[model samples]
Target: MAPAQSGAVLGLSLSLLLGACRIQAVKLSSDNLTPTVMEFQSVELSCIIKSTKTPNPRIEWKKIRNDETTYVYFDDEVTGAFENRADLLNRASLMIKNATRTDTATYRCEVVAKSDEKTIDEIKIVLTVQVKPVVPRCIVPKSVPVGSAAALYCDEKEGFPNPTYRWYWNSEPLPEESKSHPKYVNSSFKVDPKSGTLTFTSVVKADTGVYYCIATNQAGSAKCEGHSMEVYDLNIAAIVGGVIVVVLILALIIMGLCFAYRKGYFANSKPSTSYKTPAKPDCVNYLRTEDEGDFRHKSSFVI
Candidate 1:
């Protein structure tokens, strides 16, 4: 009885393993295998499924950008931003018309078959759209004072494969050597090829000229309109000297006033001692009698 029970248990385990190893309902693949194209061109990103149990499989396409997945093709129709420029046919193959750089992204082709329990097959394909360089915008200062820093800026934002830069003066390429030209003879000028920044530590009159910049990539090249740069003498030393002279004059005036105060030149005057007054001696009074009325004499005091 123990042997029979053990055999039944082994049979149940075998059934479970077989169920887990069932064959996939469908196999999905892309026709292009690896797709790459230039900007503003048509391309096909086709997906096909084989050996599907369901006659009609639900098809979908999704794109991934910046770690976010968004739907592009579904419900037997192209929807979202691609509705007007894309079409889905032949088991949900994607056909894009007039594709632009914005279309560059990773696309996933998904197919679902409904049988005894739904099954899905999906594959990912990356698309790249190359773009050429357009005319870059460049700015050169109208005027730069001598013995001061100067900067020239250039920008080219629309390009694929990235863009490189070159600068020109008077319609000629910039000199390779820093001191090779008269304008930059002082070794104060510098350039950055990647960021397109040209600088001068101490600009000079010789540095004045028409300047332009060019941007290039694998696809194409472009140039900006020529701009003018003028460098003039600032006479900054003379101005600074004048300021110092004025400050010294004011200092001298203040020092003179302080010295005068310390020497008592601003002290108060001393009191006077020149004059005196006389003193009175004494006062005497006499009473008048009736018999003496005829005599009628007034007494006076003398000092």
Candidate 2:
């Protein structure tokens, strides 16, 4: 080969090696593991790029939850959903303020180098947001007929680690089986601890009182409002008695009417309704009799 051609080939090889060395020189690394944080607090996740092939490596952050991986930071700005509470530092870490349970997810920090046409590095951080259970909402029957089914419902939606629920009767925790409460041997009911439901297959008269539901989690516990239940038995015998009394009153009225009708007690007392007298005039006028002819009566004295 010619000396000039050989020199050109060698220079090209050196340049390729130098470029490879520059890319290898970029040191991007971070060691962040699963971290737990309380609600309404600040947390920082690190993804340090010790060195980069390019002087200006762009930083990006994304969140992974369930089936979705969405951008948290892009183009040197936090996205609209997490704008106020999220911040980036030194192109390697993310700071979040007032974290909530909804913010609990896996965060990924990705660094990209435009000059090297490569992804510098990426690190994953798991974040868990611990939150206490909020007050539970409950519903129960105010009253139910005896021998009927009754159900009480309770739920606590605002909590982390999914709260476990329980039921209480008269301020005492009610068990699934009546045998747990020795004093209430006749009680027949079932309670689900997770769902906080109290159910009775056949409510009895004794099952009439206020009840409560409680929700608990790793952070704390909470309770729902009081719910009162009343079971009553229908008194058919009293209703029958009332019907009999009403029938007797109606029969007595009917008997009195029949007897009065048979005895002509409704007849009119007088027959003068069809016989009316003629009207008489207050003054009577009569013509002078002709027995005294030409009898004139006049005032004679002029004085």
Candidate 3:
């Protein structure tokens, strides 16, 4: 009786263990694996999975770069190649650090049970990681004064691959070295190759005009709307200069008139003394007097 009882207990334990080992069904649901677009240094890719069966089933994460296949994430024990670069999130999620264009590929998640049959389930996702400079709308200063610096800014928040940024003024593209315009030609105007942020140290009056920014990538291209740039105090200066010139001209005209009047008045009015040798006849010079008319001699100075 004792032996039979012992045998019955062993059989029950074996039955329980076998029942626990057997897998009823394997259900798999993947967290969204949408591709992300970001700058070169700012990319993270991860996937979540929910398994209804055993929590510790053998799992594998694969990458399909170009036409090649590579494993980036695995079960609890990640491969040495992806040791610090990959992480497992919670019960069923995989994360890749610092994702790049090279990391873009099709990934797979697989799970297999420990049963004798070794049934397996799997799911695949495509991830495209983008890495490039950020480029955004161009904003120009209200006014750029001569001998002063003016700034042209491009927002660096929107783009994919990211993008390469270039600025244009009045439809003409300015190179990195042209310094004809002093205020807007400083080194600060150049944007960082990796990032698309620019600054103008000083702006000149010639810098006033319209400006635009262009963003491009291998995938696509775009351009920002043109913004206006104006010069300061130009109208006031022109008005003042014109007024000064007109006043000077009027003063010269008045001085010339006064000088001509003085010359005419200062001229001598004396008669010629050389002609006194010839005398006129008295009879011809006598005035006619008739019917009690009297002649009055009025002295008229002709000197």
Best model number under TM-score: 2
Worst 10 residues of 1 by lDDT: 294-303
Q: Candidate 2, which segments miss by more than 4 Å at Cα? A: 1-34, 46-56, 64-70, 89-91, 113-120, 179-185, 243-303
lDDT of 1 by residue, 1-303 (tens): 699999999999998876544433567777776687888998888788755767787889998888989999878878888989998767568898998988888999988887624488898988887788899989899998877898898889998867888889898788644677785576477778888888888887777899999988877889999999888887879999999999999999999999999999999899788676755334534456777653323355334
TM-score of 1: 0.59
**Candidate 2 lDDT, 143-163, residue by residue in tens:** 999998888999888889788
Residue pairs clashing, model 1: none
RMSD of each: 13.9, 10.6, 22.4
After best superposition, candidate 3 residue 21: deviation in angstroms? 16
Question: CA lDDT of each candidate?
Answer: 0.82, 0.82, 0.63
lDDT (C-alpha) at residue 169 in model 2: 81
**Model 3: lDDT of residue 184:** 49
**Of the pair 1 and 3, which is ahead by lDDT?**
1
Per-residue lDDT over 1-303 for candidate 3, one digit per residue giving the tens place of the 0 to 100 score: 699999999999999987665544454566566656443443334434343355566667776666777776654665745577667766446766655566666877776655425457677777766544344667777776655655566665544456777778789876654455564444334554344444566554566678887777655556778888886655778899999999999999989888987889657798866755566444343345786555434344223
